[model samples]
Target: MQTESNGKRKRPKKKGSRFMRNAKGFAKQGIFGRGTHIDDDQFSYFINILDAMKAGFEDVEDRVNMANNVFEQTVDKEIHLSSNQIVSKAIESLIGFVDDAQLERFFGKFGDNLRPMCSDRFASHVLQKMLEIAFLRGLGQAAAQEQSEADAPGPAKRAKPDAAQVEEQYNLETDFSDKHREQCRNFVLRISKFMLNNLEDFVWDSCATHIMRSAILCLVGIHVPKIAFEKGGAELAKHRKLYTVPEEWHEVMKEFPQRLELWPQFVDFPYQEHSSALLGVICLSLSVVDKSMLKHFGKKILTQSLLKPNEDNGDDDDEKKESKIEIDDDNDDQGNNEKQDDNEKTEKPNSEPAVLLPKVFHYQCAVILLETLLSVAGAKLLTQLYAMLFSGRVAHLSQQQQTNFAVQRLLQHIKEVSDFESVFTELQPQTEQLLKMGYTGVVSALSGACLRLGAKQAQMIAALQSALHVTGDKEKSKLFFNCLVKLKPHELLAGDQSGFVHLHGSLIAQHILQFNKPIFLVNCILELPAEQLSQIFNTPNGSHIVDAFLQSKYIGEKSRERLIRQLDGFYVDLAITRHGSRVLDQCFKAAQEAQKLHIAKELSNKANMLKGSPFGRLIYTKYRLDTYKLSASQWQASLGQQQQKEESVGQTNKRPAKTATELFKDILTQ
Candidate 1:
């Protein structure tokens, strides 16, 4: 009877049985359920909640909090699932529902709650989702508005959009409405402020510091989208809408300069730890700020302040004294076994010394900021930076290494943006001064810039002539050599100019050959007129260049033929000289089969004259060995045939065939 009653009764349904069942299923599979099949009803329910959230339904906050709790539980139960998976799905569902009004209201009430979540890895994702949703909604509204305006009427019926209107529309389409823009700006600013306000709490915490840095970078990319514009210009504009700075964004731009002013305070921090993050923010800021503002604020505050020598050397001295006291305390511990009374031994304080900005740190930051300014602000800031570099003000700084590095970086930036000829003209008078100061990098960079700019042959030749005067130092000469090699100044060197008259073409050619082996250099050497080639081939140092040319694998077939022709009458003369004989040997080795045979025949004619000289004797012996080796092989083949004939006749072959040694002696005697 009990079994029959149990069978008759139906099981009672649990509270939210359907939701629980679906949630369990979703936890097992993905958001769309198993495979490609989607549970539309369940998806619609999820989207409905997003709609409610966007509409600010009376119980929306409570519902969202409850949903979040359920999501966390599901994630906990299903160890395979990630928090990001749930957050991504939630964000996707809310994308269509989220609008500017919703974001403003959400932030207004919950902004304070958002700051603490930035430090939480999972919670930061949700905050980022909120920002992304707000950005997408703003974009949708802008695109819709643009389409409406575009479809409005013809120019006859309505005035076409002016440049200002077009620019404004572009800003809206790209960045969003001014109100939404402000909210996004404030969102990032608030996070930055939170980190700054709670500096001690976040400074040593890696996670918090990373969040802060990421937030800053995000703000930089968003607020300074125009930075890309400065680089790509109209070429970038053709494919996508360009960003224009709006009047409303002026408030956002103001935050950067204020932050830049705080740079000095951070100088005492571990530069290796914080410099990249700080420089990234500053560079991005410089790229977006107005040129006038950049010139005024960046030049006056950042550059000028950094360029000046540190006035607080006295503070560094005090810190050294404090360090000495700490060392003495450490020594006291090792010297005595008995513990001293606190009164007897003065206890030094354990506090860190106050960090004054180092001169090197300021110089590094100044150089980086100046480079950023030059890239974005164009010629105006470039002129200012150049003036500052040459003004001798930096010489007064404590560290020359920092100043030199700054100059090198500045010159590199200038090379990229300005005409090299103009830069050279401006810097030419100071070239000697720069060299005297041991700034060879500047000279090298300047030479490269000039060459890249396609500076005229005469001018480059003159520069090379002037630069060669500082050949006393091996390192300086190497720097000049590298510059000349990269410049491929062979064309200028080949030309008949008075400037190169003072310069030894062969010496320069030898230097170029040693450091660079480009095909063009080989071609240049081969293409030299007979007079010049002969001149270079005659000199002891110059013959090495000829040897380099012959030995290079890049020497073309036609160039080889031309080179062989040039050596037509000079082989005997070259074979007698100490350096020239090496070149003659290389010529024989590198020449094609036909050229090699011709050269061997020509040298064999002068074997007597060549054999008299020490270097030439080696060439003479090589020639004789090569010619006789094939003959000796043929003689052995013939001698074996004769011996076979004798064996067939059943007779012992008593006549011995000539050995290779005997054959070589016979050829030499003949």
Candidate 2:
């Protein structure tokens, strides 16, 4: 009974001691309790301390709240914020990169944090909110800045929001707003890259993987907003609010040229359903963003991301290390060796991880930047800027490939824009440069457009000629030729007479001479009226021209029969005469020499067919010949002579006999 000092207890000493220890333990548990009750005194003390702490926390929260508000407001006011600022803010906030414990309290468990929340239902809601807020905020801020800029004077004079201040203010605002969209993009990419690079324990179901994929899909929808402007009303408004090409943003755009490479790292993987969706988003973003920016970065990002690994290092160790792949072997000996190696490697950490991008990002960024210069300002300006940037570093790419890509991208833009026609008209010089790009598709599309626009025949011809010179593809050449043929007779035949005649004359002759494969022009020529044919085939040097045709590989066995048919068709239409006789004389010699009896027979049959017809009368009257010198006997004798001459040549040279077509090719080239 020794515990009666405070008149609280008169119990036994052992009982009191045991109870006190229990009480002490219970009090400690209250400090670290799992939802258990505390005694009255403990409760009172806790309430007092909690009140004081809450007051202090409230003051800090109030100040932080004020700072956050001011930062957001100032960032909204600063119209001159760089694209990095805008993008960084949008991405950082979208992923909730900058939020305080408040956001964490609500979403930390469920958000794309290191470990997601315990409850799935809560996570989905939190993620959805983060995406919505980020998207809305990014769009809103962009719109608000544009509106403010419209109301204000020049940016420099508008406000003194330096880079740091702009970054600090908008960084958190957009970060909070976007909820860490960029981080999502980055994380998904990082996870995918890592998983692909390191297979073991790198499960596909990583949370970072899902977040990145979702974020990428969100990006894919980025361009959908721009589609509203495709048809005029609120067109500029849409572009203005959502996708702008502010001169000040040039530097910001520079950073993103290689952004596409990040996409390809995951895009090419075997089971990259998630990664592919993300890549699609990236492509959509590239398509929707400022055209100039797209032009600048599209290729750079595309190339860097798509480039394969090269192995030319002199070090065998590096080469051997690079050669390593996912181990599939099960042999005991190999497994032992592999495990040992792995353990050793684990013991000795790699000095550095392989860089996925290296110069790829820089290249893509440069290209996209160059593309932007070409898009907004026009080719002249872009070319000038291109010249400036392309001096030293661009030596990696071939000139031809670069030009091809540039023209291709330009055409893509032309296809993309609804008002491309109007824009093209306003920028003729630029169009001309695009044509000068010498890409087959680019030139062809432009030429077709010109034809559709009712551009002058001279222009069309010039454009086609330009296309033909640059391209080596036979299909494209044929297309250009056919297009010219279609346009010439209708649009060009009777033009300002000199230009028309000279143009067609030069082009037709060039085609006849240039294409030794087969003279499609001859078929076209035969289709012309007799008068036109006469004008073309009955020139001062008609005989010489005939000799040229005979020497051509194009007029060999296959084409010769066709030409004979064409000639027959032409003769049937014509009232044959002395001039026709002269032409026939030239063709007769080649047929006789080649021993083309079929062609000879056809010629004679045609002659006989015309013997009593209108052509017969014209022929007889014009020739005034008493008799026909070509006879069956003479034709047979000429054939014999050609056979003898061929035998003699074979005996003298011991050369292999050739087909009629082969002989024609030999003679024409010789």
Candidate 3:
């Protein structure tokens, strides 16, 4: 669902979004910190060149010189780019802009020493960038690896060769010889082994978690998007989504940081944030293409990490030792290092909160993770989670700023009538608090959940009436949906110069009008005076509300006819804007022929104003109002012929229904 800014042009939809899975997100950016200061050597030469490069110097010889010196300092003194900003930037420059054999040699140097670097904040970015470069450079191998694995429809489908994902139609075979590709790949294999060996360390380390995801992409052959390669070490920004995970991820996830062990750290590091977000990425990456893997992931990783303890004594889970790498002890980032603004700070101790409740409430990552879990967990796991995590927590969670997101997800997933009743029982009392708190998403989801599960519809109606203080016939009739969509009562009655619609208000309206037995809701919409109806039809989201009413199966033909007749004088009002014009078109499509004729006559009445907007002009051409201007009788004849042809065409395309005799014969034969 993450789209590039297509800017009014048709955007190429990333095919990855179509997959069925939970990791519907991506890591925003590379983790960063400055490199540790060296002993004025890789020492003397690297210090000078790194400073020069960080100062915007450009020369291949200097970069090659910098790469060699930096690698030497890394090997000899254990100094790293992760701790020093200049060094991280300079190294990023060398790896990125520096090309030819020197670049390969520069990358190849880190294969053995890569394990230590993966533990640092900024240094891990170097690892992520290196992997991106290797795959990009080895595009031939990446493409081939992808082609070979194309037929895998199950768990094995996720086990493609590391870094096999590339833009589908890119032909990069001639970029590098196979021998060179294999060499770069060997280096990648060594790095992968090193990270895989330290998977436990990476999973828990905030700085190293990004490197962990990048490595997962490489290991599972998930394409680290080219835009990721465009990110240098300093820019800690989110990239494109991790579309799908290959099967090998299960092996990688076998040691996913356990929730049983993470409870206490909730008060210390906000550890659950990164861990939960990581799980969300993993859940989405698996993309549910692999049913076996999804089942395994749901059970082994998500269920286990999030589930509560079976026993009363829940504090028994052991904690793992922290595996952080020590940066240079010297705090003097003096000299040119000042220009290297420190992106990551030295890890200092934070005073823990007095209570764990406050700490857990701020866990934003858990919200996303819970959403992924809600979508993918199997029936048994869902029941377990519903009992353990959600059963009584819906009302309490809805009050928090962070956990309310999870509450919304929980509300959206309510299916069973028993579950809906349990949730509704707890949540209905808090509606006033929720409305006061502006937890409209929760309120919106609450309405959807109630109507969707066919539970407590009358109660929902009552709750909304009370929450909005609907004490009058006018409030119930005209302003109910308007207030629900958050339009000011005054604006509904008089004006809306700007077409901006409140999305949450519109969502609440949409859920109401679309769900079971929306006749009363349809009547509320219908009862809106013509000006308000025109205003609703004038905005994009508002138009969807009108379209829903026109298209709702629960709405009778009499109700739909009333809706068309109500908009009788306002066809021009609906025709003047893009959003409104769409409603105008829908009216023509959904209207009976006589209703369509009335609509055409109205547009012809304001022919010049209807022709004013480009969108309105399109409406004019589309509904044949010009034919009405020429001859009303001819326009009616053309409209009749068009409807007849459409009916005939639709009938011709249908699968012929079997006769009763045929059905009887088939049943008897069977």
Query: What are the per-residue Cα lDDT tens digits for candidate 3 across 310-398?
Result: 23222422111011111222345542252232222223225221112322334455545666666555555555556667665677677
Instruction: Assess every candidate by TM-score.
Output: 0.35, 0.23, 0.61
Superposition error at 421 for model 3 (Å): 1.6
Give the per-residue Cα lDDT of candidate 3 at 11: 30
- Kindly list the per-residue Cα lDDT of model 2 for residues 451-533, writing each as its tens digit: 33434324344444443342355444433433332233222333422211222223334434323333444454445454444
Tens-place lDDT per residue, model 1, 1-670, is 0011211113333333354356457756656433223355545554454345445434334544544443443322221221233333443233223345544554553365644555554344445444433333333333321222333345543456532233234334453467776676566556555655665566545446555444443443332121100222233232222122234434444454555456654443323344434444444444443445555654554454444545556666767644544453576663252234322433644543222333434545455444444444445555665565443333222124444445444445553344444556655655544434444455555544443343532454445645545245543433343233322222233343321211223433443333323443455556556555555465565566666565545555677678877777678777877767767767766666566656666676777888789878877775563443456455335545655775777545232565433332222111
- Supply the global lDDT for candidate 1: 0.46
Better-scoring candidate (lDDT), 2 or 3: 3
lDDT of each: 0.46, 0.36, 0.57
Q: Which residue runs does candidate 3 get wrong by more than 4 Å?
A: 1-193, 204-207, 217-272, 285-362, 471-478, 487-501, 604-607, 621-670
lDDT of 1 at 557: 62
Residue 375 lDDT, candidate 2, scale 0-100: 45
Better of 1 and 2 by lDDT: 1
Ranking by TM-score: 3, 1, 2
**TM-score of predicted structure 2:** 0.23
